[model samples]
Target: MPRPLENLRVVDFTHALAGPYATNVLAQLGAEVIKVESPHGDLFRAYGDDRELAKLGMGIPFVGSNAGKKSVSLDLKKEEAREIVRKLIAESDIVVENMRPGTIKRLGFSYEVCKELRPDIIYCSISGYGQEGPMRDYPAIDNVVQATSGMMMVSGSEEDPPIRVGVPAADTYTATMAALAILAATTQRARFGTGQFIDVAMMDASLIFMYGSTAQYAATGAEHKRTGNMGFSGQPTSGLFRCSDGHLVSLGVVQHNQWVTFCKAAKREDLLEDPRFNTIYDRIDNAPALVEIIEQLFLTKTGEEWERQLSLGGVPCGMIRTVSEAMELEQVKQRNLRVPLNIPGMPNADLGVLGTGFLFAEDGPAVDGPPPFLSENGEEILSMLGYSNQQIADFLASGILQPSKKPETAK
Candidate 1:
């Protein structure tokens, strides 16, 4: 099967998580992404827990997101480098950047300049706020965006202090949203025969993940109170419960029939007939009493037993698992969501790295190669742009073009 974006070329000027991850998605979809890096490389190259990997500038975090791309390091301040980039953009289909607003313009490769180079170039700029906001120039990361977007407020229990999510929710979601918007723009280009300029803001994309509570607040003028582990339904039966084994089991018994089934499955049909717990409202009113009864019932069975019984009995239930436990699940392994990558310098054994969040039936998402070393393909990329061997060497010697230096670990 033919890959979807196999014929497309992308000039990626993104550095950190959101921008890089966004173009990484396009790369997995088969775009030939040429990652434009500065001399020192992306800051994320020094991020992650592995000391050796960090030393090599192939930190786990960077490795996870940057597979399937060629790297070209250039000092944009130099006219020679800017000329090379202009040549690249002229031959590319898409251009993406995550710099502060107006920064790219100062670097001489703004949307106007790129559009001049390639009339139908789809240019996307991912920023903290957007191109035209008061806070547009403000710096933002995952936690900061979470705090500003009101996402942190709705994450923890009402009594607890606001808690940013453990993962880089803002970066991850924003990247996904940007990739989606880029694909949508491609579709639009197909119809209109003109490229589009996409502006994606981390704050705006963060709110999309909170659409449920955001819409509710908009419709009713009521703020959402954080309910901790409770399901969105707010049903007494739909929350995390401790099982006999001291493990937590989430029960999603929202529908009336599911509640009835839950009660029957637990051998506590008395809950069904209890006046204080008969209806959804009644249960809400007597939540403490209902929760106490359910808690005691759940404590009588191990998490596995409860999962098996409740799930087989048509009640939505599952044991809460740690990341390692979740990854070890047979179902997860069968799904092949994570792909094994042969990262150079790690070891002979294949290293497992994350792929696209979704799958395609025909030519599914896949990486063409491992995450690049800094300017790993600079010489080759320059050659492709019609630069001769002498010109490339001269540029490299003059510090206009930085060449790749494989880490000592790889040697």
Candidate 2:
């Protein structure tokens, strides 16, 4: 009946998306993740509320990344709060943080501090860059990282300036990587009885994604230009086509033989025989004409029809479904991807669009807790640590264990 990470305790000092995301994955697999937050709380709660106290707990991002964890509000600047966090560390097996490079050490609670408290502690730091890179100190968001890592430059249409992805992809990807690394390190610790400090960089993950084109461009001295919907593999027929219903389907005829199947499916056998569309290079050169032809052909059917044909023919293709559609798909439903999350005191709490990406494939307990109210458990937590009610009341009065209250109450 035990989960993969049953009984393991985690001290989560992460916010926004990346660091919290990693620990949330651990929480899903049965670790106890205590999320320590500043007094005002993670900035994302305001992302939905626009700074009003009534709007404080509205966290679309926070809900997605922080489900199945306990939230504790503590101003680490205060010595009282820091001491409480130290107590939590004494009972924790993992500690995750996503502050700027030196913020934790400056707060007087570095990896060394945690290691001294718990020798087998696994400490993870997820930042824009690794802890010691020349660019480590620079604060970065997902779009900024994309631009700096050259992902934006190669991600757009040829006619437009570099465009950041519509989603915070770098943050999400790096967070997934961080989770994998933490799991790997935890696995190693089972044998060695030693844990390590893991440093994950968002920019580094972006660069790795661009490695293929970046490496080719480096050796060839040629810049890789954007080809709109055209994929980088130089597939002549790999582009999005609009159906009569105003929907799109990504058709990738990457293989020469797939091209024949695609042409036959589209009822365009003459294009196959046409010398202008014979080879991959020729198809790339004649993509404009090819697109025109395909567009005209696609207008005769709907996106659903093309998806069926493409799927049946074993051609590489995907229908451009909306987020709702994607969420409702059979595969997604089967995977239990859209987990129902109910946070405490929220009207309707559901925290998962970009849920845990590190799937184990084995049937197991998923992350299953409502996001905690800020410092809601402080008194209980301290009591569990042997602090009496009077000690807890003193800490509460001093604002050491700050807990959020109803909107009409004090600040």
Candidate 3:
């Protein structure tokens, strides 16, 4: 099967989550992605609390987003290393970097430089703010961007301290959007024979995720309040409820039909005739009383039983599940959400990571191979650029290609 981006080559100069995630998407779609790292490798390789893995320079976070790409360590601070990168960019279709604004330019591979090398190169820059903004140079990570973008304010209850999302939503979404932009640019290049620069800001992407709330605030001139586990529609039945087993179930009875179905399923058909609960708006207005009654009824059954009955009765509901439980779900297996990776030097040969979000009928997204060790393909990449074995050795000796010091057991 011929993948969509099979012919494309990408020079990836990204670290941490956001930039790597975008390149990962490209790699999954069959682009030949060469990930350029510094002599110390990507800082993400030291992220997380697993000290043992961090020592080996392969943190879980790094492995999660870096699969299916070749790694080549080069000290961009050196002129010789910069020359190597220029050569790599000249031969590639796209270049993606997530450094702070002006960092890549200082290293001498800005959009203008790349365009001079490759006439139709797609250069993407991912940053905290943007290239030309007041906060362009500010250092930001997922949590900081989440707070600055009003995401934390809307995440938890109003009484709770501003809670950051458990997952790096800002970084992940920004990466996804970057991939989309890059793909769009690729299409444009094909059509017009020209390349362009893409500036994707994590702050902008975070705001996109909050578009619904933003729209509401714009129209009503009132701020949207934090309502934990409650649907934004203010539906009385669309929230979490505790069952007899003390476990919780999320019920999403947003539509009138679902509300009526829920009422019948819980043997509370009298709710349909009650004036305060007659219409969706009426139910919203009397949500407190309605929720109290529903909670009492829900406490009569276990969460699993309520899930079974409500789901069968056409009401949208599911039992709250832990991360482990969710991963082990039958649906997850059926959808092929988890994929096996055989990373070199890792203790586990068959490590599981997430698969692409969606599938294609032909030539779909797939993890071509495991994540590379730091500079794992340094020699191979240099050779592809027409360097002789002696030249490759000299480059390695000059600290231009810093390969990983693999454990004896891995060798």
Candidate 4:
């Protein structure tokens, strides 16, 4: 089948999550993504290992953003390597890099140079604070960005300390958003003969996630706080309640009629006539008593029992499942959320490699082959550039060409 963007070429200079994540999405969409790395490889190859698990390049994090792409190793510090990158840009449709603001420019591959070579090129720069900002040079990570943007302040319980999210939510999300912008730019260029640069800031993305709170704070100086299991503004019938099986279930259908319907469905008809909980604001004023009412009624039924009941009655509610439970969910698994791909080149050669985390139209890309051994494609790539075996040997001997060194985990 002919895939979208199948003819497009992308040069990826990003490392870790932010840059590689964006490039990974492009690769899944059928772009020819060339993942350029240093000789030592992306730092992510070594991430997430502790004393016991530290046998080799675990490559867990690296695998997430590097699937469905070809890798090439080049040291940009060398002028010869810089020329290689420039030549690559001249042939590529898009370039994605996540370096400090001036790093690429110093390497002589600035946006202007890139556009000069390919006027219709879409160039995206992912950074901590964005270019042209006061703190553009400052360092950033997910936790610090969340704290600076007051995201953690609004997560978890109000009484508990600010907590970072369990996942790389900010980095991964920002990567998606940046990729969206790059695609948009590409579309605009194709349609109108124009291309431009895109700058994405993780902090800015975090702030956008909490725009409503930031707007309210700007207008009235009120801070949004952490409310454990309770909806903001203390709305009744909009929180987690305990089920008979000792599981937590959330109910977020806040419409007044839904409240009435929920009470009937839960067999708590007496609450309809109760004066203290008659109106929305009235219930808000008496949240504690109303919560106590819902909690007691909810505990009468098991989690699955209440789920079916609420779903049938059109009341938004469900269980507070852990990651394992969610992965094993019937509907989720049926949707192929956790589709398995075999580790390429492992002893079990019958299994193929898994490409990307997402699917398009139906299933994600069928990897078609195992993850290539490091430098497995080096000879082929050089030959494609019209280099003979003798020249290729010279480049390799001069350290101008690097075949891949399999990370420890590859063995």
Separate clash counts for every candidate: 0, 2, 0, 1
Q: What is the TM-score of each candidate against the true structure?
A: 0.96, 0.89, 0.96, 0.90
* Candidate 1 segments whose C-alpha is farther than 4 A from its true place: 347-349, 407-411
lDDT of each: 0.90, 0.80, 0.89, 0.75
- Give the worst 10-residue stretch by lDDT in candidate 2: 402-411
Which residue pairs show collisions in model 4? Answer: 375-404
TM-score of model 4 (CA atoms): 0.90
RMSD of each: 1.6, 3.1, 1.6, 3.0
**Model 1, 40: alpha-carbon shift in Å?**
0.7
> Once model 4 is optimally superposed onto the true structure by TM-score, how far is the C-alpha of residue 362 displaced, in angstroms?
6.0
Write the residue-wise lDDT of candidate 4 on 1-411 in tens digits: 666668898988888788888877777777888777777667776675332211233255665566667777766777766766777788889998888899889878889999998988899999988988799998887777877778777777868998877787778778988888988988898899997899999887877767767777888998777776777756768788889999989888577898888888887788899999888988989988988878888889998899889879888888889987987899876655543545543433242222455567854454332333344456666566566899778767877778666545555
- Candidate 1 lowest-lDDT run of ten: 343-352
Candidate 2 lDDT over 1-411, as tens digits, reads 677898999988888887877787888889988878888877776565423422756567776666677777877888888888898898989999999999999997899999999999999998998899689899998889988988887776889898888888888788888888889989999988998999889987877767777787778988787877778776657888899998898988887888888878766788888998898888878978877888898888889898988788777888998888998899888877777765444555434444454466564758676666577566777888788999888878888888554333222
The reply for model 3, stretches above 4 Å from the true place, is: 218-220, 404-408
In candidate 4, how many Å is residue 162 off? 1.7
Q: What is the lDDT of residue 363 in candidate 4?
A: 41
On TM-score, who's better, 1 or 4? 1
lDDT of prediction 4: 0.75
Q: Which residue pairs in candidate 3 collide?
A: none
Candidate ranking under lDDT, highest first, comes to 1, 3, 2, 4
